[model samples]
Target: MQRPPLDPQLAITFFYYRDLPQAMRFYEEVLGLTLAIDQGWCKIYRICSGAHVGLVDETRGMNKWAADKPVQLCIRVSDVDGWFAYSQSKGLDGLSRLFENDQLGIRAFVFRDPEGYQIEIQSTTRTGA
Candidate 1:
């Protein structure tokens, strides 16, 4: 089998929402993602390096949000505890206590955006062998 030619520059994960402004505020103000591009109906935010997330207005978007959410955005950070504390202070919704997973080797917690998209902030747990 011949491999297909692939040249990837960047990656973006898009989420469709009915309320664009509310979604924007949650991502911009609460989550602190910087806006890299704004296409009027759709806004692109830089998550890190070459990773981005696009927020699209439902009327202008190709798809709509389903009741069953099939996606969860996970962000690896240096400080899970700091993010958890900041989220609590900001009164974010659907916050989970920081917990460790031995198999995954991470300490993490989850919270929901205004549109009910789950965002997980995690840090790797280092073990001295």
Candidate 2:
């Protein structure tokens, strides 16, 4: 029998930012993520049921902010088109046209967050995808 992996209560991806207020506003107002925890310098927002994204103030965080952000935050939703329309209304930076990836079986679009971090909104196109 195969052994089971350790079960964690929550998952958080932390991103350090030079301007924490700008990052927080983008996540809260634009993305509509609810704040789960606030540690003064770090703020945790719930992305989904058990997933979270943590924004850290670079001055107080373990890591410093970098100009070239290589990480991308992706959210899988049921209504890609609706979300696209909403995103259009907001005039998000570096917004891309809605597209599909047959191999990945996803209908998606991407845009940059306030600090240039790429955020991908996608939905499964085919069953069992």
Task: Give each model's clash number.
Answer: 0, 0
Per-residue lDDT over 21-126 for candidate 2, one digit per residue giving the tens place of the 0 to 100 score: 9999999999999999999999999999999999999999999888898999999999999999999999999999999999999999999988888999999989
What are the per-residue Cα lDDT tens digits for candidate 1 across 1-129?
Answer: 999988777899999888999999999998899999999999999999989999999888899866666799999888788898998898878898889999888999998888888999999997531
- lDDT of each prediction vs. the true structure? 0.90, 0.95
* Best of the candidates, lDDT: 2
Which residue pairs of candidate 2 clash?
none
lDDT for model 1 = 0.90
List the candidates' TM-scores in order.
0.92, 0.94
